[model samples]
Target: MPSYALLRRRRSGSRATADHATADRTADHTAGAGPRRRLRGLAYLALGLPVGLLALVVLGALTAPVLMACARPADISSWADAARRAALLTFGILLTVGVAPLAAAPLAALERHRLRVLASAPTEPTAPEPRPHAVRFRARYTTARAWREVAAGYLVAVAGPGLVLLAATWAVLCPIWLAAPLVVARSSGGPVALGIGHARSVPDALPYCAAGLAAGVLGIVVLITLVRAQAALSRTLVEPRPDPLATRLVEVTRSRSRLADGFAAERRRIERDLHDGAQQQLLGLTLQLGLARMDLPADSAAGQAVARAHDQAKTLMADLRELIRGIHPQVLTDRGLGAALYELAEFCPLPVAADIDLPHRPPQAVETAAYFAAAEALANALRHSAADNIRLTARVRHDRLTVDVEDDGRGGARLADGTGLTGLADRVAVVDGTIRVSSPPGGPTLVRVTIPCPPHPQEDDR
Candidate 1:
């Protein structure tokens, strides 16, 4: 082992080295970040120029009729001329309304891309595509999103050129100002003309250099600020404003999904604990009781008591197994959904005609929701419908899981009648699924549930 003094010296040297490394890294980052930000701002200004010009062209086209109408000279008082102008203006108005959305859409998309690349700002998701049968022109013209795009285009046309001009002025002046000392030194021995006074020597140019430094710093600050402002305006006009109702609905749906997942996880945990812990202990106890009965005399009272205890232990063991299966079945975990449904049918008293055709297993949450919904429906049918024969059909169709439980019996099953179906409905809703019951009095009852789920990749691999 090293001496205490030597260890202390080594530790101090290591700490000092670490501190130096951290300072170097911080300095390097600071050096890199300033130039990166300035480059981004400059690029944004340069790109905005062309976009602004294009927007101006589009706006001018849209306003041509109004401009023409306003510029109609106070000469030529002919009725035919006025009528021709009126007809032209009316046609122009119709054309403007038609062309506004077409021009605004591509321009808005380009602006969004520019903001994303240069300003690191992401806009809201675009609206979904219209249906094939939808009236494309009318649908495009009527939407608030389309109008917002038009307004954004107008804003860009008005503000973009002004920002570019300001940036250009700063870009030109700041460099010249910063090079004041260099300019003075490079000039002939005669006094160099500075901004307002003459610089006879390098020493005389010091004040101008200081002023240049200040101006350069100020210019950078102004450029960054204006870039940020432009990005904010673009985002405000291009992105859709969040609707309070829609936001709340999304939150509620997410919360419900989380709760459903938690419930499924908890069920699995309970099943695991019972299967591994309590069930094992119960099995061992049953074996012990059986051994005790065998070792005792058949005629003795002790042997009879042992026999009765052994029988009770076996019964309890079976009940516990059933309880574990009910919580979350081992078969469901090991053999996927189709096997689990068949196992469920095996336990039911009524003869269940199962027609299960699944190409692959769905997500765990969806599978759990579907299994419980089906189980509840079948239970309700067996208890209330007095059904002698039942049909359970489960299949994956169009990226959705559909399960139908139909029974032939005297049926008056109504969800509003305060049955278990209400709880089932709530359960299905947690996973964004739906349950429907069609039961007429004195007839066959059909309980159908539909849950949206894509096939699992692991199952696909299998």
Candidate 2:
């Protein structure tokens, strides 16, 4: 260990060293960075055209071999010929639509850095949300950015670069040829031929050099034009388009339909389980308890208990049966919506008259939607509408089922009053159905529901 003073001295020396290094870095950054940045900018401009040209070259190389094979069908076996024809057609479409877009993705991702450093344009990117594989794949081709990028690729990677390459070659070579007279003037005793024509003397070099100078100038102008054009094209094409609300509405509608289908299937499953499994077990238990009661003395406490247990089991079984029917009724599946509506009307608190006429049963989905809508309507009328009499009328025609529920009840029934009308409406909408409630402040309420019914499965099979 050193003395405290020595340690302090060592620490000061280290601090000085670090400070000097930091200052040097700052100086370098302030002075040297500008030219470094300028050269980098120039380098970017210089190589941008070539980069685009190279992309075109790569696209050609990648696609050419397959394309050549596709061109001649007779050279390959018949199956292979057919397969390659299909593949070639697919490739042609991919190329026309989005092969360029796929190619541009990498460049677009990195181009921001190049633009900020060289072109002086910068844009922030939005964060991407995770999506299912199918959705992501669809977006790759369908997005406007991808399509615009496709357009940009054709101009930047193919057309712009091609012109730039040709002009660049002439620009570089012609200027050197402008100095050709010096060498030619001494080398040959006779006239030497150049592009413009023969040069007999040193004075003859004027036209040659002037022509070369003009060509070089033109080439420079073209290259500059191409660079600016490419940058602008990229900016325009790589941005996304604004989506409309109608599109979102369609998606929401599809999602609701899927959910409704899933819910209906689940209800059916629950009904099947309760009816076939639990309810049967309870019924067996009830029968066994009745037999036990018969074997015991009537006045005994044990006998009384057994009798009571049997009655309770029977009641539980009956309730389970009702619950299962409520979930998904066997009567609806067997006898159709018309019969189901009649059965529901029979159970209503208020007297109901039903007029249900149909040539044949509709599709299961349509029947289910109509049955539930009618059930909800009847319930709503009895509980809130204070209805004494209800009329349930249904008719199937023109590939549709229309049901009308009319009640002579208290004047007002609004969906806003939380009468479950909106829920029923949504259920109807899932099957491409419509519901209308016409209820004014006075007395009668008419709820009309219409559902599309596709051709019956038997009709479809025929």
Candidate 3:
């Protein structure tokens, strides 16, 4: 039994040792794979270096002749020669500047393809707007994007290959040269050296060979880093920058609109809670007063008190209902903007003529903005305007809801005025809307608000 147990212990120890060896091999493989893959990617750029250089050469060839022709003597011997000279200068200028876009089409396309496919960049070149071919050609020449590519191409073509060649030579050739001396000494049993001095034996050659190998490995790493840097620069120079102010403005507007919607939702929630909870309690009180009155004599003080209590509860309940409506109307949610506006007009003390025409409900933010704007305008009219008649009109056209509130009153409503028009303007703007108040001094004041909605929603590129 003791011998058997000893054998079992040995087997377990051997298995654990084998597992550890396997893990060590895996770790080494993982570490080396990263550098190997990086080097492989670097090779792709090295191969591309020649193509870039060749493109630069082609561009130079196309542009150089034109330059030379332009520089040729303008004061020719004959009128015919002068005409020819003028034509040549024009051709050269046209080829370099005017037709440069056309000349660069193939190179730009190739660059875009390389970026998208090989380098895995979303560097898709914007297609020229479709028009007459001549028009398109002219546009391409003028386009900054196309011109930038030409500039980048010229830079890469001239310098890219030269850099790649130097890196490749350092990374590949030096190591081979260093190792050759050692290999020769080992094979032939003779002296060899990689030029620092003659190595008489393999031991003499070892240091030089090892130095070369280390340098080659380092060079490979450097080459990969350079390739990566070049790609980054290329991408930076090519991509167009979005307008900072415009993008931020859009983002801010959207954010504000979101806040406005949230505020409206919260208001609705509070309105519902009050309507459901408090209103029911008030109704129950009114009912209890009625029940208490029925059980008592009609002329009794308690009966009279009960009657007054019932009336007061009913009046209070009505006031609370109106308050809830002001907060966030249930009519607005159930019957849409038209019904809501109509209900608002009915409550106003002044004669309000409402003309609300809409096919569908707009976005919540837009609807809320429009509703509050109309309400504010009416309030302003009641406070300031001496007019008895107010006309409120809402119409939806061209994917926008326009609300107009006109009051005949002594008018001088400015954004400078602290009469809440400025706040209304800001609220309207949150949903990418506009508010225009034509309230000149001494006459009819009209507040018109236009809010965007539907078919064409606001873009959130920011």
Candidate 4:
């Protein structure tokens, strides 16, 4: 086993163990926390709005009965007595009707805040998982907050009695004022049968019930409207921070694309330089020697010199060939990625395998990128992985051309500041492709390349 392979295997084992250990620690913490969390909730409830509202309602109900009992007339035993109490009864009813409106005003504001608080709570949970639609307000109110909101509603109910009393008092006073003039006139003897004794006035039943009901309905409607408005306001205020992540993603993709184009362009320029400069010069020199051979005698000193030139030209040709191969191997263009990769595997010192499935011929750019990435990956495997074997697989599916370059060697491969794979990655990006390198510092190292399929003609139009 090579050193890199052994190191990779060790790293893989450690990662698995660490993951399990962390999970166990998390579980233990959660288990211990459950009971205490519940107790804190119960404590908040005992002192909170629910308790306050219960006490308020209890006090109101207890006082209401006693007050009503004491206020009732004891001498009213006949219809005539009932008529006396009628005034007080009318007063109470009218007061109740008048007060409902005033109570509704603040009640509406309270309802608005209640809904707003509810919506805000759910939104505050740290980063809920993303969904297709906008996040819904699903705030869970703590017992304390719920109680407080409900208790505040008591203020709305409190003003009810006062409103009714005001209306009833006004009703009584109006009748008395009208009767005062009549009573004075009667005292002056407008009619012998006329008297200034108290007369019961019939209270208007229609106005009392209609006013109270209308006030209640209006209050409820306004409350709902305000609550909805507040919810809208809260959403605007506390929305997710404008996610610049998508913009960053686009920028990164473009940057990668530019890097890819630059890398590819550089390789092409280098290849051209090698072919036009050194390779051309070597070919010319060989041709010149061939022509020189014709003028020299077989056994002559000139002939021997010609022979040496011929041999030198052949050696230089070989050197030129090697240099061209280094730039972009001939096999790559001649036979496409599959054959070129096989040639790469044969040259590797360690064991290697090729699993290639080409559904269709890819575009020239795609093939070129794949070729370079595969070659560079193989070189890295041979030099660093020290692995027993490597796997090279290529396939085209779902409008994407994918290639997987794997080595069973010591993992932990990073695109360092200066590395052949880094250059290869840049090249791959030119065709809107991505490269992911997963090499834990252990046995298996994998490099996956994915290039988006070129758009169809119809898609381009759309």
lDDT of 4 at 226: 41
lDDT of each: 0.83, 0.76, 0.76, 0.61
In terms of TM-score, the best-performing candidate is 1
Model 3 over residues 344-397: C-alpha lDDT tens digits?
899999999999988877766677778888988898899987877999999999
Taking all chains together, the TM-score of candidate 3 against the true structure is: 0.63
Deviating ranges (above 4 Å) for candidate 4: 1-245, 248-252, 269-281, 290-312, 329-335, 342-352, 387-390, 407-419, 422-446, 454-462
The sequence of per-residue lDDT tens digits that candidate 4 reaches over residues 154-266 is: 53234323333433444454444444444444454333221223322223222333444554556446533543453454334333344589779888878876776566567
Most lDDT-accurate candidate: 1
Per-model TM-score versus the true fold: 0.77, 0.48, 0.63, 0.39
lDDT of 1 by residue, 77-112 (tens): 899878777777787778778898878988898787
Off by over 4 Å in 2: 1-244, 455-462
Q: Can you give the lDDT of residue 14 in candidate 3?
A: 100
Q: Give per-candidate clash totals.
A: 0, 1, 0, 15
Candidate 3 lDDT (Cα, whole model)? Answer: 0.76
